[model samples]
Target: MKWLLLSTLAVLLALAIAEGEVWEEDDHEVLIRSERGAKNQECRYAKGAWTECDSKTNQRSRMLTLKKGNATNCEPTKTMQKKCKKACRYEKGAWAECNPQGQMTRTDKIKAGSDSSCEQKREITKKCKTKMAKPTKGKKAARRNRN
Candidate 1:
């Protein structure tokens, strides 16, 4: 029984290989690749550290070096890019005087070398203390006279 089972498993493995199926395990995932060709080469790559986010494009990239593959047919190194969230930088102007609504506003201009997706100009508003009106002396004098 054991011999039969082993032989069946071997046959299945052979069939899977013959169909150009490749299984690979990485740090974060297990992937499979299939190719339809008489001669298929399984390539393995070593992923390098990701590069810093690019301000202009808002993208991060990494390099993949081929570790095991048919060098003649496969590229030795490849670059992969992915979209990234970048913090917007701006040159802020001084806050303007508070308006009658008790709100102060400032202008923020996109800084040079900032991400392209950042807005060209932004208006920021904040609450401020509203000026209080002083009591009129005439009203106080009339109240005293009435008393």
Candidate 2:
């Protein structure tokens, strides 16, 4: 029983070491435009880490590998995060549209602009009307009616 347990432990350890590991012996090839390797084959990008050559995948990137079925993926770095933050195509500026009823809405942030002129100098003349929700019940209602 002890021997069987030992054998099982050893096998698990070996499998853990072998999984998702890009070894020096793997003949990783640099392809044009991140092409994925075939099943059990190793392909890689010109730069970066991670190799899923033994698995199933077709997605490829520079210095990355694809497995037998799924596409290749790489761990995102700071650069990727920055790219995502600035991905929006709109330019950094403010735009305002005022309706005929004097309802004005200011432009929100598209990107962080330093010297945006979204502010207006003239004061608006529109006044909004407010209605009371609940009128006074007894004495206040009598007073309001007299007023």
- The numbered model that scores best in TM-score is 1
Please give the lDDT score for candidate 2. Answer: 0.38
Q: What is the lDDT of residue 90 in candidate 2?
A: 29
Query: What is the C-alpha lDDT profile of model 2 across 1-147, one tens digit per residue?
Result: 999868965765455346643322234433221222333443333335543322234332333333222234432221100011112222333334556674554333434452233332323333334445875488877989899
Tens digits of lDDT, candidate 1, 6-108: 8965765576578665445468432334563424555567788889887789799988787767878656776657678676899988999998888999999
Collision pairs in model 1? none
When summed lDDT is taken over every stretch of 10 residues in candidate 2, the lowest stretch is 77-86
TM-score of each: 0.38, 0.18
TM-score result, candidate 1:
0.38
Distance (Å) between predicted and true CA of 29, model 1? 19
Error of 2 at 42 (Å): 12
